[model samples]
Target: MKRDINIFEFPLNLGLKKKEHEIEPGVRKLPDGFRKFDFHKEINPQNIFRLDAPDYSMEIDQESGVLNAEGIIEYAKEQADFISENHKEDAFNIILGGDCSILIGTALALKKLGNFGLFYLDGHTDFIPAHLSETAAAAGMDLAIITGTGHEKLTDIQGLKPYFLEENIYCAGNAETDDDEYVQQIIHSDIHYFDLYELRKNGFGKTAGDFLKMVYSKALDGFFIHLDVDVLSDELMPAVDSRMDDGIDYTNLREILKPLVHSPLCFGIEITVLNPDDDKAGSYTQPFVKNLIQIIKNKED
Candidate 1:
């Protein structure tokens, strides 16, 4: 079936205040020397799809560890409805996120349609419960909340059990500064962990090929690919809340994702953590967006 694609942008910064950054309107404008890096200039009319998340007010309470859970649920419901309506027409949902927490809503939406596998690409595990989180950031608990392991309001947003089984989850290129307990949790969880050192030694092409094969074998249906900018090397992608120096490099990322982008089982892709504050006058973000668009367009062609 021919695929219809929708690109949705969630721009709120509710999850980042704890990290000391501020949010602003509009795409971060490129500085004088960075003007040549605009990614929108390369858009292909035929294969591209776009949408924007509703502008809901957001607040973060560090003392109480309470996020606007109700608002998040409402936003998630809207996203779920959009996906359900579009799925009937054979369309794919490509979400650009405000923060990693957006995954909770996206995953909830996907779960409503039946079973789907998650390809979570990030530097951190994102499995910490709200109470235990050092930073108490909502983004930290995104994956756990969707899997029904956190607060009731966050976990029960979709009126279902955990979105997917732990066995069905896959994390690629993780190189976080997690504590020992977090490390043990990753080692113990059913989620397969492919460390950065392994990818470097085995080469991204080989590593990604093996991972995709494993996913396809286990996934009876299709899967969604979620990309967090923090997964990229800090040198190349400085526009994220979590900047790890030893993460995947741009070249390796392209190699790792190309096969999956073209895979029949790959339903959609979500790109997150495009924090304009950390970016150098949009210097870092434009090229990354260009590469992502190119990857998707090449697959379409």
Candidate 2:
């Protein structure tokens, strides 16, 4: 049951607003950044594909109430097509992302394929609607959009509303708990929510095991793991756009990802939001690439 890995590089940064000092969100450099550490060479992916992204912009679409709505939608369509054309049923796909917004394209591709579940692992809930988001960055509200909570233009792309059904999602590793409004969105929804505190209490390995049970029980086409590097502790991974105070460590990451990555039903996983600009020195990226390679290869060996 050794699945060959196929890597897709989607260097899109249209989800976030550029800071005054920066030209664009540094997340766009994520794919190349990983390459600097020879992540692809070490993993030895069967095929590698790269999708060029649009230039950075901060235009807020008045209709959709999100930044770069038109650009995001356009890219998502292209992304879906690219994925559908190259996606192999047997090989595991690893999508390297520019930001959390990359999920839209991945989600669209999955929806077109069949009934799929989502394992959303992020430090922030990313469940806020357009009005609630001060920045109106799609990256901040991607989960909500994918789950059919935002404007119809973004959520109902190609008539696929709610790319992933709420019941089939397991959103874990949220550390931003103080904002009741932010935390309550997912809590109220059908998504199985697990904040940082609850995750540790239930145990990381056990939580992953529990999620696997649901995947199996549903008899889904497959599940995709969404790994936002920001889910790592601030001390260990501070190169992300938004930094949380405390998060799970490397061991916890491995424990949670092992079973999910090894499961035969897994379609693939996506890595997002590890900004190279913030990690000018390869210190953080080095360990991240090393740990991730071990996790992915651990199942094969």
Candidate 3:
């Protein structure tokens, strides 16, 4: 069935540690930034929901050892509740994130709904323990938190620990393979891992096809996609918080996303880590907004 589209804007950016020169991460501007290029108008979503985020801060929680842990948990609960209240089975949700940490709330909401698979596409694995994190930012280790590998406070929200099973997730497009420790962490986990080199070697379309097979084989209730724009090459999209050298291009992006976006059991996608503050001229964001709309619009056709 072709599902209608719904957009949810959660502009919380507290998950990131403020850089030395900047006041805070600028990911919070993502939703409005896309709208500036007519992203929302082209999709013409069925409904629009937005949750205003708290002002940015860089406090490290003593209890969880994560930056802004308390604020992240607070917003995550509200995000889950908001999504639960307005969720529609037949509508595809396009969650515009404040950062990668927004997955925590959506994971919680999906947990309440039923077992869900996750297709994680990012420039980093995001599967490190808090102790190993250089920044102590939740965005750096969200995959670990959601999979019950962190402090109980963030991982076990309301006793729903392990929002997503390790084996049920497919983490693709990691470019940070230079660090053995960082690479080894996710390698030890059950999530199916595909670094950027391996992703291209296997072929983007085939990699996505393989993930779909897993979703069907597991008979999951539905699945959510996490898209961190840094997965695109620095040449193509360099407006992200962390810029890696080489990554996929727009053609490769559509090759991977089209099948998944059009799938019947797919829930929706969340876009993260695109800092509009860096792309003041909108050169990168313009093409991003255009290609993404076409990918979604093709689903209806």
Candidate 4:
């Protein structure tokens, strides 16, 4: 059976538009400037998944504070249909996003097949609820939704919880500004987190190796790796919405991800929040996508 890789392009910015009470009024009033980036032009077209039809769509309801959860699920069902039709073959859903919120839809689609673990690599905890969020951005709540804890529409994707227990989730390279409530939740839950301070103390290679061993030991049938580019330092990857200087460098980032990509148990991967408006003559963003393609191609070889 041929291995299928589908790239779902999601470019909506609804999550960024939502206002959060916790954020300072000054930050909340800032103009929406991140949307100007052209992700389609920055990414190498040849490296992405090709489709006979459009692979991206969106619908947002600000009054209800519900993102296009229904539309996302519908698109996910389409991807599920494709998987059902091609069940004899191995398939991978590579979701390239408008923002991180799209992970909810991808997770929903994967849940229909069987159980799977999640590898959430990001700079923030992304576990904030809509009401408690410092910035009520839907992107910030992606992980919470997948873990079965946020808005009903989000957590109830496909009418089933899409993720494993909190213990099954793993976070790599996060910053210090994470919310206190979210931090407490992580401590109480089984989720594993590797902060920048910890990475610097242990070394990226060692930390990644340890994580891989731990993930493989869990006996999960499959796993999905979600990469939020903000996990990289601002110097290396400046195209993300949440620009922060405190993240892993490019070399270390690659070292951490290489083993996961090579693992047979990794069913799919998603790369989110690549904003071209912040890109430097397209020089900074292209290499990352190229490296990702190389990693996938290496697996093929």
Question: What's the TM-score of every candidate structure?
Answer: 0.83, 0.98, 0.98, 0.76
| Stretch of 10 with least lDDT, candidate 3 | 292-301
Q: Summarize candidate 3's per-residue lDDT along 1-301 as a digit string, tens digits.
A: 2589999999989999877878789999999999999999999999999999998988999988999999999999999999999979889999998899999999999999999999999999999989999999999999999999999999999899999999999999999999999999999999999999999999999998999999999899989999999999999999998898999999999999998998988899999999999999999999999999989888432
Better of 3 and 4 by lDDT: 3
Question: What is the per-residue lDDT of model 4 for residues 203-233, given as tens digits with 9 covering 90 to 100?
Answer: 7767656656766787776788888888888
Question: Per-residue lDDT tens digits of candidate 2, residues 121-143?
Answer: 99998999999997999999999
Candidate 1 Cα lDDT to native: 0.66
Which segments of model 1 are wrong by more than 4 Å?
A: 18-41, 45-66, 87-89, 299-301
The digit string of per-residue lDDT tens for model 1 on 1-301 reads 2455655555544444444234342222222112246443443222332335445334654434646555666667776666565553355556666777778767877787668788788888787677777666677777777777777777776477687667777777778644777766667778777777755787778866776777768654777888887888888887667667878776777787887777777777777776665665667776776677667667332
Off by over 4 Å in 3: 299-301
Per model, state how many residue pairs clash: 1, 0, 0, 4
State the TM-score for model 2. Answer: 0.98
Better of 3 and 4 by TM-score: 3
lDDT, residue 83, candidate 2: 97
RMSD of 3: 1.4
Give candidates' CA RMSD values in order: 4.1, 1.4, 1.4, 6.5
Q: What local distance difference test score does each model get?
A: 0.66, 0.93, 0.94, 0.62
Least well predicted 10-residue stretch by lDDT in candidate 1: 25-34
